[model samples]
Target: MKYKHKYSLTPIAIAALVAFPTAALADGPYVGVSGGVVLPEDSSNAGEFDADVPATPDFGAIPAGTEVGWETQFDTGFAISGQAGYAFENGFRLEAEVAYSEYDVDTHTGLTVGGANIDGADVAILTRGAADPANPTVGAVIADGQGKVTNFGLFGNVFYDINTGSAFKPYVGGGIGYQWVDVDYMPSGVAVGADEDGTFAYQLMAGASFEVSDNFEIFGQYTWRDSTEEAEIPLTLVPATLGVESSQSIISAGVRVGFGG
Candidate 1:
């Protein structure tokens, strides 16, 4: 009887040890840093310009036979963001993210004609830094003597994890959010092209999160948004004509860190 009792106790001890390791590897709470390049699937609208004002000193004067063909182009910059998330035992999770990226578009054309085209011939030609509401007159000109537009926003997401037993896990998620933007158009002989305006924006996002360790990993994502801004500009020199409007979508990749159960 004594020998049988000892044998049963031995099996129980072995089972307890085997189960401990598996429990230690499961999910819990954590914090991390995620950063990468942001590439939007839809173009972000920088702003618009519709001014029939005189040119400024910088642009001199309107040239004879001068025509305007303006465009806005986007660039690829860096993205850095921080996020916190929770994973439930059933593989469901919710996350809130705040990411900031420098979104910009360049304008290459803003010309005038049948005028003097003097030393300040390029005056009233709107460029990147025209978003200030100091001089309302300039703002009015860029607005086609009407209105202007600008683009900027914020977002959030939800997802479900795939159970693969392996150390590596992948996730799919979707998000929605809003943006606050500003546009300005100021007129100055010295300042030339100027503008100011603001708006509330929106967007949608989809991406995958990678888990490298129990505490860290990397991810890549794509986002699409509706971005539009308006500004005003005025000319103090020769007659001026301005046209600035365009949109772009961006793409990016980055890494993340985790800290939790």
Candidate 2:
């Protein structure tokens, strides 16, 4: 059994600065921070056994190496970010940001052996490497344990503050970045197998802000990001890569403070 985290309060906003943009807030330097909920899409073909497996007591033999696929389902998670940038009087702004996010695994889906789908204890048997004389057969212990995906990212962004009249303002922008994706999973046994790597990534965002004064503004936005390549997580016993790509949607709100001209 797993305890999935739930978010009852909706996100208030998200923000990004662009090089060629129109904006408001402050004319000089500013810093911001935000936190919110994250929902990760299901991943297909996350990874596979890099080599051939002879046979296991729980499941039969599998051949053709990479054709053996691994898919996964994930529960809702959380995300946070901090950024520093300068807003121009002309409305264009450029900034840098760092963010982190995590998701819990619901189950390992779409595992197959000899053209038939395998699940429950059978999936664990193969993942725990039943073929290995060192590992005994693991019966029916799927998702009774733990698994998750963790990510760290850094980005250079641009945003434009749109003129909406009064204290309310809307902004839109995007950026390019790098991501470190990590996977740790143990579906069938007590031991855990993990893998992590870095990749090229990018995101698009939009949000609105309300100016409370000359130096402070409250804001929120929705952000979507994806990796150019898949995350390959290789583990022992499993003998395969968990090929989940780093992708997520974030709903968040934060405050920005400006100083100097």
Candidate 3:
């Protein structure tokens, strides 16, 4: 008679089965650095000056009610960021990050003085006599500007990683923070500037990571950042202010190192 042998998991096999999942989903602290491109959306209503102001007695040949409109076109730029965070066994993480980026201006158009679109002649005239007491061209419109915009931000983020029981994991996250933005408009011989307050900033993120080792991984992500704030730009010799708003998007890749799970 052939006897049937009882089959069961060995002690080591049982221990391995119990510990595998926990080891795969290790909890630990991590730090990372990323760099990529910054693509900014249109900056609408960047600046506006009153088109209905009377010329001062001291200013010569300066017309009243000259409407000057300025809009900014942002070119793609570079972004770099660093972050530190702690991940939990349930695939949740919390982190703090700081990032910086710079974008070049594509064009600065829509300048009008006394209902007449400003041209190269107008700019030349204004440049020659803008500050001349004997020939003051105060409140003259100067357009077709170019410059760079720089942004620095700090954020607190929360994310959830989707574990797939493989080497690849996907994640979605969001963050809220503060950003400082500076806009510098250089119109050959004129200076018009605007600055954003240390205002509320927020972002949405989605990404995937590939585990190369037990404590190291690489990730790529897309982030949409919104950083609109009330901005005021004082006009030259005018009692009016211009308002601007800003927004941007980014894509990046980086490496993360985990410690002490």
Query: lDDT of all predictions, in order shown?
Result: 0.43, 0.74, 0.71
Give candidate 3's TM-score.
0.73
Q: In model 3, what is the error at residue 124, expressed in angstroms?
A: 7.9
lDDT of 2 by residue, 1-261 (tens): 999998664343222222113234668999999999998887774455677766656566555355545567788999999999998887777989999999988776556544446553333455544444454323234444368889999999999988765568889989999999988777754444587889999999999988776678899999998888987767665556556766799999999988835
lDDT of 1 by residue, 63-161 (tens): 433543223334454455566677667777666666555533322223223332222322224332343445243323332321223444455656676
Model number with the top lDDT: 2
TM-scores of all candidate predictions against the true structure: 0.50, 0.79, 0.73
- Choose the strongest candidate by TM-score: 2
CA RMSD for every model?
Answer: 10.7, 13.6, 6.5
Clashes of each: 61, 17, 4
Candidate 2 local distance difference test against the native: 0.74
Superposed by TM-score, candidate 2 places the C-alpha of residue 212 at a distance from the truth, in angstroms, of 1.1
- Model 3 over residues 1-261: C-alpha lDDT tens digits? 999999999999997776554334347898999999999886764344454444444334443434455456778998999999999988899999998888887766555455555443434344333434353222233334467778889999999999888778999999999888776666544566644455678999999988766688899999998875644555553434565566888999999888845
Model 2: CA > 4 A from native: 1-24, 55-61, 113-115, 120-140, 143-145, 188-192
